[model samples]
Target: MIVYILNVIIMALGLYCLIAKRHIIKKIIGMVLIEYSMNLFLILIGYRINGLAPILLPEMNRVQFSQYGVDPLPQALVLTSIVIGLGTLALMAAYAMKLYEKYRTFDMSEIRRLRG
Candidate 1:
């Protein structure tokens, strides 16, 4: 329940950043936040209380193993999400830098030159 609340809060923060912030860089940061929140929510969905790593060994019992093992799918998904997020963040930063160079400001409203 607590984790669900936190996830909701994280999503709300990202939405607020997207809606209220005026800087292009801020919008990119908001996008990153949204991505992170989604990853976190996915991880939380796979979490078990007092869960153990799903490694099979000679000492492990089959029943306990199945009951206590952590889900590997979410971990894999989170890793992919993080890699994609890193790539996206880098691209956004580079774009922001170019925007700054051209407009000399981070404010989105002030950088509008192609308005039609």
Candidate 2:
């Protein structure tokens, strides 16, 4: 329950930053926070009580398969998500720099050029 509450709080904070913050860099930080929250939530969901490592050996038999096992799917998914987030963050940072260079300011309202 605590984990769930924390996840919700993190999500709320990210949403608030996204909606209330005026700086593009702040919005990017909010997006990163949101992504981290989602990843953490996913990891929490996959957590098991007394779970063992999901490793296989050539000499191992199926008789004791239940005793030494762990979920690898979530780990793989998390890794992929992290890679995607890194790419997104890189792109966002690049765009922010370009925007700053063009507008000479980081204030979102002052940088508005399409007020149509």
Candidate that scores best on lDDT: 1
TM-score, every prediction = 0.88, 0.85
lDDT of each: 0.88, 0.85
lDDT of 2 at 3: 81
**Backbone clash count for every predicted candidate, in the order shown:** 0, 0
Stretches of candidate 2 above 4 Å error?
A: 57-68
Model 2 worst lDDT window (10 residues): 62-71
Query: Where does model 1 exceed 4 Å of error?
Result: none
Specify the highest-TM-score model's number.
Answer: 1
TM-score of 2: 0.85
lDDT of 2 by residue, 28-111 (tens): 989999999999888877776786556777777766656546567887899899999999999999999998888898898897
Per-residue CA lDDT of candidate 1, range 1-116, in tens? 99799898988999999999998877988888899889988888998899988679998899998999889899997999899899989988998999889878999888878554
Clash pairs, model 1 backbone: none
